[model samples]
Target: MKKLLLLSISLIISGCASFGEGVTTAFLNKQKEKDLRECRVDGKSFGGMQGNYDGSNNLLKVLMVHGVGTHIPGYSTQFQEKLAAELGLDEMSSHYKEIKLVNKEYPDQDLGVLRVRRLLDQEQDEEMLFYELTWSSITNPQKEKLAYDTSGEYSFRRAEVNQMLKVFSNDTSPDPMIYLGKHSQDVILASFRTAFCWMMGRDWDALPNESQELCTVGQTAVEHLPDEDFAIISHSLGSRIVMDGMKSMASRVSKAQEGEPTSTEAAFITDFQKKRTPFYLMSNQLPLLDEAAIAEKNSASLKFKV
Candidate 1:
């Protein structure tokens, strides 16, 4: 019953036009001129990408993580272009590097994809690497239970608006629920983890091009961690993923520090502590989701200390 309620809420919240705009159209239009769609940001403000590309050989990297919907590799193209223009980066690579993220331990599992593009200023003095992580494929199999409902056999019987709502619900409502399941969240986190490694470890030329691979925190990442800047842009469930992923990373580092931390782990932890990696969340959903268990009392602090 609780799950059903959450699903219903998700359906309503996930941009069902009829349920949303339909009911509010008259009032919205009446007050549209007077209504203030204010964006209230509550947190410490950090300088955005502008400061990251200081022409110092340090690369500015941003990763885009989508929330609870199916998305393709090129989903961030338009946003990337706009961001590039805002950053005064007019030149972009003709091709993007694609990686089919897979965990070596679970080779059969489809962890989703990482698409990378390089953006440069007109003079080529400043550069940014844009990484787009499409992890919807992780929860897709679970959502397929509703696939038959969307078929003409069943969808034809519903009212047009109802059908659209049902399809929207089918596509999005199950993601949070699936992430709550046994290992689904783990798989999604692995997808995020690999993307982070790829973002930190290599430049545009070093990344694999159109290949299936797993990324590990290696020497390259340890060496580059000090010089490069990293940030994340996420929406919806992605905010939760980034939060949890950072906590998980902190847990590993904390545990390693307990005994004897390896050189790579030590370097990563030390360098990570020095840098401020900001997360820009759109339609952030961390408040709506259940919090994961954290063994450390200050795990949240540890997560952000980096």
Candidate 2:
């Protein structure tokens, strides 16, 4: 029952539409205002993911991650608004700034921004960047349609959903572990690609020359770190990405220290988060009843990582 409720809440949040007249833009494929509407219609729920990057180099950075279900780009914007309200920051005073890296490495793409309520210290200094990872591309409606028509990796027929439910219900008619694993992995990989690119300083829609190609992202990761402090906010599945990304970047740096000739961009990945970084996780499903023990696995996986 708790699991069902949590799923319902996520759906409700993702489905809510708040259409403001803010400019819609991104790198590699920045669109005009009219194009923004067209693209939104094309993707059905995807409002377009942006890096929320401005030209100025602000130091403190925060990454927001979203979890399961089909989500639109509006999710990020809405989350920012609410976050601002809760923190007693004035949203009207701030605005969204779309940035496009104009070098040969990044493709033209769509980017969005939510410059909301900044946190001010006693020194009256305002410095912190909040980046929301619009990785809903994995659960996007149009993308799902394409994936289903091409390869059935993430497509779930009625029977498949039932089978998955059986696993949740402890039905032993057939072991659905493999089925669940494949679907889960498929979604995770899709999201990982999106999140990884954004973190590595590439646009979310960045097309790599090779599928295995990974950019040295440390410098890019710290580009906006105006201060040594950082924080992360995760909803649902985003927690996994934050933990995994931290580990992935950390491993890269450690390898370099071992004389493995790691990419120069690898040194500062963990450094990006070590300074006074705090994580605020919302809509977390762990406390909800998870019969399959997925929550326990998440707990273990999150252990012992900065």
What TM-score, computed on C-alpha atoms, does each candidate reach? 0.80, 0.44
Worst 10 residues of 1 by lDDT: 291-300
For model 2 the local lDDT of residue 29 reads 36
Candidate 2 differs from the real structure by a C-alpha RMSD in angstroms, to one decimal, of: 18.5
Measured on C-alpha atoms, candidate 2 has an lDDT of 0.44
- Write model 1 residue lDDT over 1-306, tens digit each, in one string: 999999999888876876677779877778767756798979977667787765475478899999987887899999999999899999999999999887775789898889999999888888889999999988887788889999999988999999999999889888887887659878888888878878887888888788886678888889988878788999998999999898877787778878788888888888887877888889986756755333223354665534
Q: Model 2, range 23-127, lDDT digits (tens) per residue?
A: 222432354334534433243442111122132333344567666554444467666666555544343324433322221223332222222223333333334
Q: Model 2: number of clashes?
A: 19
Q: How close is candidate 2 to the true structure, as a TM-score?
A: 0.44
Candidate 1 residue-pair clash tally: 0
Q: After superposition, how far is residue 299 of candidate 1 from its true place, in Å?
A: 25
Residue-level error in angstroms, candidate 2, position 18:
39
